[model samples]
Target: MTQDPVSIEPLCLDEGHALGEFYPLKQQAQAEDFPADPAACRKDFLGQILHPRPGNSVLAWGARMGGRPVGLCAVGVPEAGRRWTADVVHFVVHPDVRRTGIGSRLLATATGHLAGLGVQKMTAFTSGPADGAGAGDAFAEATGAARILRYQRLSLRIGPTRLATDGDTGAGCELLHWRDDVPAEYRAAFAAMSSRLAAEEAARSGSDQVPEDFDEDKVQELYAVLRAWGYRTYLTAVRHRETGLLVGYSALGMADSHQRHASQWDTIVLPSHRGRGLGVVLKRANLSWTVEHEPELATVTTWNAIGNPAMLHVNESFGFRLDQSGARREWTL
Candidate 1:
């Protein structure tokens, strides 16, 4: 006997067990070699929903088969603004119902909810599954989202040599590491570079929803908070050598420094500063600094957009390979 298809609708957060059942699917979709312990996935999904932040959100929607959740999708809006965008964050369907259009309906409906709230753009990440790569690629095609960024991951084995290349100096640019004490002359230059880097990534300095007094002081405060929380990997690169003008920078990070995997994030080189090979120079400089200062480090990871061949070339020279690839998709109102 054939069973009828299930219907879709938003499930209130208060709708308990039915919503909780979706964690397994989220885990399988999210991680490779995911923990078998039920508590791991359960804690993660709920923890984010409960994280205290002004615009944090979690919306779960699904359809049931035989009174059980046979398909599901989730969206999270951790922040929002006019010229800003929200992330699809998480979306998945039960394996049994995949390829049945159930996931599409769930995503379409959730995107509608975001649009109704005045969202202008949306994003979701895609890293190839442990087994295959089609899931995120196919979904983005069906939706209206265009891929805006690309990331590639790489690995480093022991005794590997560092990547070096010819540096460009015709642009009056060179890379320098920020010292324990920032030079007085470079404060304004550092600020300008930070502003450009964030702008290039479409991150606004602040939104109207945030207070007017929010400034760089607040930023330093947040960094201080991160420092207190043990998330600190203090690193900043500047072009102070070339007439004291700053052109490129990279922020070093680590999930758990005690672990083998450290990471590089928030890397940027000015548009006019591009093609000079300053990126590679800066990275090598940072790498040398890290190896000398922190000998315990084993491997470093970085992501490059699948389409960003330029940065990929620079990173590849240093042995960075695909650690993760997230497919980003969206729907416009």
Candidate 2:
């Protein structure tokens, strides 16, 4: 007997409860058994609906089979620079009905919303092959999307031991720390170094990431979003003693809802100051602090492009192990 096809409908903040039933799909789609924090998920969803990334708007839709929600698609359109790109951040369907057209239906609906918003390019990510075939890899193949680049997700367990104790800031370098926002005096230099780091990262991985023109105002805007969403950010910045300029920085962020998990966001050092071991110093300082302040934190996850060996070496030295890998994929509208 043939069954009826799933119906796709737009989802709003008020109807987000219906999408909660499919939360298990998150673990199924990823290679690792990520800790399930329903509270965190709900908080994040509501926050994005209310206050999206500094300059971005989101569109979400749910798929229903026999009048019951079974899948979801979420797309974010940039209101600022990367205007042409729409990120399909989350797309998941229950395993039982995965190949039964639910995913395709949800994807079509997501792309439709992006098209209506004048989005020219679409970007999405899928977990790398776990077993013989990972869900993300299969889905991309089925949808004719191009696999762009692969990144390694590494994690380190926080134990009672300090990984790196040598905090020596070699010749002309000094270390500074921040909790939420870059200080007034360091904003300009931080933004310049950050922008340069972003451009270099994008070029190394062949990604379509646009180098942001960060200024004091832009930095403030991002900090505002983090505060509104209940995120706590810990940062380590290295300043040049002679020039009184910031040459490198690293950031670790954790959300109140997900206390057990922390993300190692960005670690960047200016080209001229690269060989002085600033990356190691920044990472060590932040890790030491995180282990002290965030006792509940058991895991720190970080991603590095396959082409980035220097950072990979730093992470490996800190006992970080490869948990899973992911591929960035894209489609042209």
Candidate 3:
């Protein structure tokens, strides 16, 4: 018996709506533990596809059956740096169509598209244990990809004293926190710290990640997009009082309407200021701020590299438990 051949095609702004529609169906079929709101997910997909920020390009491919999308594979390439690498954002296939070779076709086509752009390396992340019988693990194994790094997604239940801790001040430094926007006075220093951390992270991970292109204008632009997408950002930082430099930083991001979950993003302390317990202080401040402003916020999720014990220790103190785990897989061509 012969089955219909899967048709994989590139998607652009014209098929953006189709990609949005396929996402919810795919999530519902695959991710049973954490179901996504179709409307919200669709809205976010459309927003990113139709009006992406500058210096970012998307390459998306859809698997079609009977003229309807049944699978999706998408990746993004930064315009400014790391032109040789692509970030695989989503790779999903409808449940009913599993083990039917559709995913392989979609992946092949997506990779072909990336190859046309001269991309030399590809990176992907999925949510499951490496040894587990998860779809992501299966896909990685079948594709000859190597799991380079392991990470854990931890969730902290927000309650009285959930994220509160005593303030530990460093010599000649003070802490500052803000919501929604980075203050003008500290934007430059903030960008510098963030850029260094990004570059260092790439080096440690053995990826060709170029330095982060962060500036005051870039920070402002990010805040604008967050506002447009209905997200509130809380930022905490420690600055040297004498030098007026940002030595440590952390952030919490919560959706405006979805008050149940917040994401903890980008915590870093400068190498020169590493021993001051600044990581814990910055994280605590941001978590406290999120709880105060978003009263309905129940759980905050943060991702940590398995090798980073310092940050992990701080998160443990805040009572964050492992909610999900995954391995970062990369392939070089």
Candidate 4:
């Protein structure tokens, strides 16, 4: 018997909301504890594009298994990260639609557009830690993409009490930390910093990673989207006394933005300023802002490579405990 073909089209605002339904389902199926509200799904989807770090476009697509939306895949190519490479930002299909080729179809559409944009390669990330089978292994295996690195997500509890920031001074050194917006001037700086990130990523690389190689203009687009998301929350930077360069910077915001619990988005320090501990300084400043301003914040989470001890130490000082309790398996293509 012949089955109807799945239609495909470029994503637009109204149509894209369809992708929201898949969020909780994917979460539930993967973790068994995902929340039931579809509204949370919409908030997360809209937030990614609207604020803090908007990077890619999406699609509203699915198949009719007896005439219902049963699959969804969002292919996003960040405007700047990983250069022109595209990424499988989100991909999930109803278990009922599992064998119908819906996943592949979505992959094809997303990759095609990205390739058109001059993206040479594509990278994807999805993980699972299901009951001791190497968490993300199942999904990673299904996709056929090789798993190069597995990032561990961790969190630090911000105690109910306030912390100190009196030690820091804003003399010639401007501590540019603001969440609601990124200074218009930093948009250009972010792009430069983004372009420069390619080399920086290369220096730390031990596995294949995308977005790590993003360029400057892509960074600018991301900043624009982040500003829209009300995530313009944690953009912190330190300037040089003589050169006035944005020598070190950190971006902090929430992952589940509606959840109020903050998380580290991105942070970097110029090789020129590495010895100065500005990376920690930049991050600490942001944490101070969060604890001082948002008392409702519960936990602030971040992930770091197991091998990256320097940062792990900084997180420890701030009380971020290793999320040894949580892990995810990954699938890549």
User: Which of 1 and 2 is ahead in TM-score?
Assistant: 2
Lowest summed lDDT window (length 10), candidate 1: 204-213
Candidate 2 segments exceeding 4 Å error:
1-5, 14-40, 80-82, 129-133, 163-166, 207-209
- Candidate 1 C-alpha lDDT tens digits along 1-333: 676767887777765566677666666654532232122235435433333123446676777777667666666664555324566545666665677787778777877777778776666766553345556766777666665554445555424356233233454555566422234555555556666654544432122222122234444543444443344363556574546667777666543223444567656677767887767777766666655556666777665655456777888876675545554454555
Regions more than 4 Å wrong, model 4: 1-17, 20-41, 46-60, 77-84, 95-120, 130-136, 166-174, 206-220, 229-232, 255-257, 324-333
Query: What digit string (tens of lDDT, one per residue) describes model 3 on residues 263-323?
Result: 8999999998887678888888778777778887777888888878888898997788887
Spell out the clash pairs found in candidate 3: none
Per residue, candidate 2 scores C-alpha lDDT tens digits across 152-215 of 8888777766544737788778888788888878888887877776776668756565655677
Q: Summarize candidate 4's per-residue lDDT along 244-325 as a digit string, tens digits.
A: 6777667776544445567686677667666556666777777777666676776776766555566777677667765532
Ranking by lDDT: 3, 2, 1, 4
Please list the residue runs of candidate 1 whose C-alpha ends up more than 4 Å from where it truly belongs after superposition. Answer: 1-25, 31-84, 94-97, 100-102, 129-132, 148-160, 163-191, 198-234, 239-245, 256-258, 271-277, 288-298, 306-309, 322-327
Please report, as a residue range, the 10-residue window in candidate 2 with the lowest summed lDDT: 30-39
TM-score, candidate number 4: 0.73
The estimated TM-scores of all candidates read 0.62, 0.87, 0.88, 0.73
Ranking by TM-score: 3, 2, 4, 1
Superpose all Cα atoms of candidate 2 onto the true structure and report the RMSD in Å to 1 decimal.
Answer: 3.0
lDDT of 1: 0.57
